[model samples]
Target: MFQELKPIQVETLLETNKNETPINYYQCDSYVLRRDTTNSCYAIYVVKALIEILYQLRNVLFHGELVPNKGAQNVYKEAYLILKMILDKIR
Candidate 1:
């Protein structure tokens, strides 16, 4: 499962008015945040991030803010698979 997992890429918006540039970081073992040099973006731990994402999704769903689009479907599918894999291992 870990082998098939891909790092999530995050990009910082440039502060045009402040003339500030974002600094690129090297990968570390912190397990919270890491820089993916190949992708030029920051990556986060899958399990941690996924759980937070699901929580947010639940909130949006309950509030009727979520749109059942293709992208949303993909996210739901991926989350289901990962959660199912973990449950299978535990059982």
Candidate 2:
């Protein structure tokens, strides 16, 4: 899980989280990455997917596009990726 985060992957997650870039260059594909990385990958989705989802979330939140519900876990999941990134950096 946490073991699956490469330095670049961590950085990419944080960058996407901070900058709200609805894209990720680090991950090839979520479905494939879910298999390529590890079965219990660090994020609920691949780091790439989390980044894109978080960026979209920030956009929706910033623009008042819709009331927050349903996918709130996605943001929390992104936060988890951040924490994992920090922890991995520490290690």
Candidate 3:
């Protein structure tokens, strides 16, 4: 499904620490979240969601939530809709 994501081109922003450095967390091998911006920043959250969506579809292709059929395709397609929604809201 990676071929269909049409991945949203977002500039991922990481959160800062007391010394104003970026923060990163390796949330398992499938997903990792890194924060660099200050509070209220959304770029990181959006990126994290995108990554999660990809990971889910990738692993679900076998025998979990999605079968190796048409349903898996739909999950990937929704990510594009989400991208459009985010862009519209930002613009």
Candidate 2: minimum summed lDDT over ten consecutive residues — where? 11-20
> Candidate 3 residues 5-82, lDDT tens each?
968775543323233234443343555545434466555576687768766666666447655557657866786677
Q: What residue pairs clash in candidate 3, if any at all?
A: 14-35, 14-36, 14-37, 15-35, 15-36, 15-37
Local distance difference test scores for all models? 0.60, 0.54, 0.59
Clashing pairs in 2: none
How far does residue 43 in candidate 2 sit from its true spot (Å)?
9.9
> TM-score order of candidates, best first?
1, 3, 2
Q: Which stretches of candidate 1 lie over 4 Å from their true place?
A: 1-46
Residue pairs that clash (backbone atoms under 3 angstroms), model 1: none
Model 1 lowest lDDT segment of ten: 12-21
The residue-level lDDT of candidate 1 at 14 comes to 27
Model 3 segments beyond 4 Å from truth?
A: 1-40, 63-65, 68-71, 77-91
Candidate 1, residues 1-91, lDDT tens digits: the string is 7656757655442222331134334323542243343554434454566678777877887799987889988987887787788789999
Top TM-score hit: 1
